[model samples]
Target chain A: MNEKLHPFHIMILIYMNQTGVVIMSLPHLLAENFGYNGWLGVILISLVVNLNIFIISIVYRLGKGKSIFQIMESSLPRVITFPIYMILIGVWSMTGCMVIKNYVYIYQIMSYNTTHAMLLKLLIDIIAYLLIIKGIYTISKAATSFFWITSWMLLLQLFFIKDFEWARLTPFLFKGDTHFLTGGFIVFTAFLGYELCFMLFPYADNPKKFIKSVYKGNLITTLTYLIFCLICFGFYSFEQIRNMMYPLLDLLSYIRLPFIERIENLLFGFFLFTTIVSVVLYSWSAQETFARIVPKANKKVLAFIILTFGYIVAWFPDTLSEVGQWLQYLGYAELGVAFGLPLLLILILVIHKGAKPS
Target chain B: MRTMPKAAALLLVIVIIAGCGDQRILEKQGFIQSTGYDLNGTKNDEKDNRLMITVDIPKSDPEQRMQRETLTAIAHSSKEAKILFAGQTELSLVSGQLRSTLFGVSLAKTGIWKHIDTLVRDPSISQRVKIVVVNGRAHDLLVRDYPQHPRAGQYIDRMLEKESALMSFPLVTIYDFSRDYFDDGIEPIAPIIRENKKNISFDGIALFKKDRYITKIESKQSLIFSMMKQNFKKGEISMKLGDGSKKQEYLLFSSVISNRNVKVKRSTKGNFNIQINIVVKGSVLEYSGSHELSKDYDRKKIEKRMAEYIENEAAALMATMQKHNVDSLGIGRNVRNSLSYEEWNKLDWNKEYPDADIRISARIVIKDFGKFK
Candidate 1:
């Protein structure tokens, strides 16, 4: 619990959390919203996320590197802060459970149709639980390893360059349907996991250096998203991408080597590492929020409670669409907390400073 | 703590064992390599089946690895046929290894979208599986055994792969088919194969308007269409050029590299004029023309003649496509790019494709002659 994460670990942790299971369907979402050359919208979305990151950095500076709970509780009334903590706990744990649930749903659909989905999700949950019990420092260390394991997947994009066509990208800019609102929202949600960084203030030795690592982590994630979206746009036509359920998976399936075929199955299995990291991180955040509320609770017991709560909740959505619906709602709520929490903290800090001179 | 470790180990053991329940035994699973769909032409009032589906499942036994078990079922849907197929085989039929899907000419003429939609929907099926059109009954093609090709399914798969690489015909997978089918600017196409004597042969390029097979490009003219359709580094094209007074002149170019450029301009009317320019460079492997290859000027004359021959052939090819109202060359894509978004949306490309004036020109450069020259 006393260990602090290195700047490199922080960077890779943020990158891993941002990438989760959404990457497989991201190309289809972009094509649906922005049409041809919709990949250009990722840069715009990334800038908005960077602005959010900037806001969080401001909170870190104004609060003098104190924990977010410390800053909020000291200024706000217990009545106001208590419900905010409850909402954060609900939103974060639900997001955590939904991420794994969505992954397991897709896994069952792609590989194990006969296997029980909850059984599969339970297996994933157990793996995530083993990691979450170790705390954030260990999770960050494990995340650095997961980052190395999954980042090499971007190199597979090279295989598509032979068939990639500029004409398929088209000459139009943002020529898709009127669904840009939902598209922007979905793309915005892909960047949602970074907002959990505010919970990491106490774990940072230097707040200024930690914020820099967050930006670096976000840069890596944005580039990864940009590369994937561009390859999918150029490899598949606008209409084909729109019709595909998971264009990235299909692209991976098309890769055939002399020794191996259907590498998508293996690569998708490797994605388990990143998914586990994301699940553990989100659950850890929820557990930390729980600890703030109940100061005397055991950390391990709190983690168990959160995981059990998540496991029970995962049973309701037996199908992929249902899981996806819940995830979309949770994503929207997290996005609200991501922006709202920081602005609220800044409001408290400014009022406190104005009310009493230093 | 010791009991906890033991409990964890027991849990791991149970999970490891329970996870094996979903394991698929290789010998027990019958992998369908080739599937053929044909319209039932027989008049059987009792069994009103629209589709005659045939599958080639290779035997798992090493001694009979070369042999395949062919199963045929008549059902309205592919899944229905799949259930019927499962009843005949002890081995569980799976489509994870499906390599090629063949549609009979009769069935293809009607439209293949519904069957293709099912294949696309199945998560187990690969997107790279070759989509082929059969000139004869697809049932006949799959049912017969070729003497020379011990494993006909594997032979067809390898042949399509090699031919597609040689640019004899474009390789149209399910991914390509659906991509072009969905794109408003271009239509889809597939290669046609037929049973010829003891083996299967590449017939030609099958053209489609939407999902129905409209026409075909003859094998001889397939090279011309391939050149205009895409840019490739290697292919072969043979052309015949001469006057009535001279001996019949024929030139065959090997390792032909071709690059195509399409320019679209709005004509005086509300229609469009499309200009296609193809630059080809090749080494002469066989020349029976009057021009002497040893001389630069004579070689230039042969090049000019070959260029002229290609231009005329492409013009004829474009005319045939326009006559049938099939924009197989993706000329509509270029025209769409030339217009604004609203104009492209309002215009019916299929209607404007035939009325638009199209021209083709070829520039051929002989990079190398043979050692004989």
Candidate 2:
């Protein structure tokens, strides 16, 4: 399946993974943690995520044409590997659930107002099921199309700068070095999509193009996030920016044209496409891990089960704070897999080479 | 497979559920055009904090001569009053079309930050909606049917928008207010509207020391204030030009081009002196004076005289504002931009601004001084 993805298509998949429901309320998280100095936070987070991507690409070189599953099978025992596979599956499925839940909640707030949560979840699950059954090839093609779907989002930012106060980004010198480090870790979960590169790298048409394509994808995500942060900073007060749960939507409401009354509703409706791609990709990855573990099991059945499990678990969090708590724990686990695993594997490989008298 | 019917049934169920939710029929909902908030009392009682909300909605039939409905209520907050308004209207009222909000003098002085927070939090309201301070009770204006635009909200909104672009007042939106209110070195300023000649008109500018209204400047002073702060698309400055003897005559300077720059520097005593430089380029539209302006030297003399007068007036306005410790001109913001974050945090702007020296100097070019001798 390495031949299925072109190098450029990898960028689209990574971009889709990087941006979604998370970017909607990003200003809230960044401003709460960093104040007027979030530009520094953007720099620091990108630096760390870039380091993670580099290490993962190194792991790919070590794979030596072996898929991640094959590499793990050759290096570790089944007992150790089996639990790791289960954790990955759980992570992918749980994160997909969070994305679905958050996007649905935001949609209700912005559009429907009082939609039945179960119905929204059912609709998303069915769509994701249909797409996931077609597998990665279709998902990648959908992601490529979704790239065009969402490319118009940044145009809204251009019209919005007329209200921007350049002085809002004032006192431009960086002072809070420690706050940047803390803020970097605080928003570490937002940079989770690039971590998918490690698993998806072996599936690229050329693993040699994986590093550059992933970095380019990561760069696009970073710049997009930076623009959003700076625009929110310029357009909103520190306290206002800090308090707004959805600054971008609030900003969109500011754009008053005679023809359109509720632009955010329509925009958020289009954003559902990005969410579909996200949930399907996550469940599809979980599908891959499921097949590797069972080997002889029916994969389509497993994929549907994974998506259904996400839809069911998404309803358990009755409160937003519960979702926050879940995501906080999930963020830590995600960081462990993104950074801790690759670094540990590199160390193990280094020692193994040494012991083998290479 | 036996799953095709199950899938079709599921899809049908989802579609039915989606269409069964709330239907926001446009005609059945009252679209609030403007809102007015005033404090009920003056003390620490809950009644003191009780907010009186006045909302204006226009008639759907455009041909109706008297075309507006005014809803007034007293409640704990704007949100509460909105909920209480359901009893008064046959249609459900929605606030998505809100054009402007006016706060009574007492409410503004008491502090309107919390009220502003409610506006910003509501996703339905537009951030471009103007916020103003009324000279008297806010509800008074909402009830008056002006001759030009019977709806008080549309009248006030159009007046504010036009004046903001073509006259003396600054364009103050909810977005601008929130930005200035939260910044450490600046404070928000909005236009003041008052009952004049049985109709509402822009009276001046309401200045704030933080969120509380401190004082206001009349339209004449507000002209220079607006000029010193932002660029104008077009406006006029009219004033009496001399001592009450023969030189005292009216002059209207129109087609005005002006800009301002503030420089913060250390004086000889190591204290800060902010130098404000203003340049005005305008042609005299009306001159009732007897002075000859055809000569170049006379034109130079008139230009110099106008410059001196503006400089003196602007300086006096700044001195009065400094007496009240108001930084509505953003001098503190300009100075703060020049320092490190630590230094900015350490400096007390409130203390420094009152005692700080401000100098305003102007140069009026008088592009084409009027029609004739």
lDDT of 2 by residue, B214-265 (tens): 9999977878887777655478888677854655877898888888888888
Interface RMSD of each: 1.7, 2.0
Which ten-residue region of model 1 chain B has the weakest summed lDDT?
Answer: B41-50
Candidate 2 C-alpha lDDT tens digits along A300-357: 8998788878777888886666776676677778888898777766765666652222
Please report the candidate that would top lDDT against the real structure. 1
The CA lDDT of each predicted structure is 0.86, 0.80
Per-candidate DockQ values are 0.63, 0.60
Stretches of model 2 off by over 4 angstroms after superposition: A172-182, A347-358, B1-13, B42-49, B61-66, B243-246, B267-270, B288-296, B367-373
Candidate 1: misplaced stretches above 4 Å?
A354-358, B1-4, B7-11, B42-49, B63-66
Best by DockQ: 1
- lDDT (Cα) of model 1: 0.86
Give the DockQ (C-alpha) for candidate 1. 0.63
Best by TM-score: 1
lDDT of 1 by residue, A27-100 (tens): 88888887778888889889989999999999888888788888887878989988999999998898899998
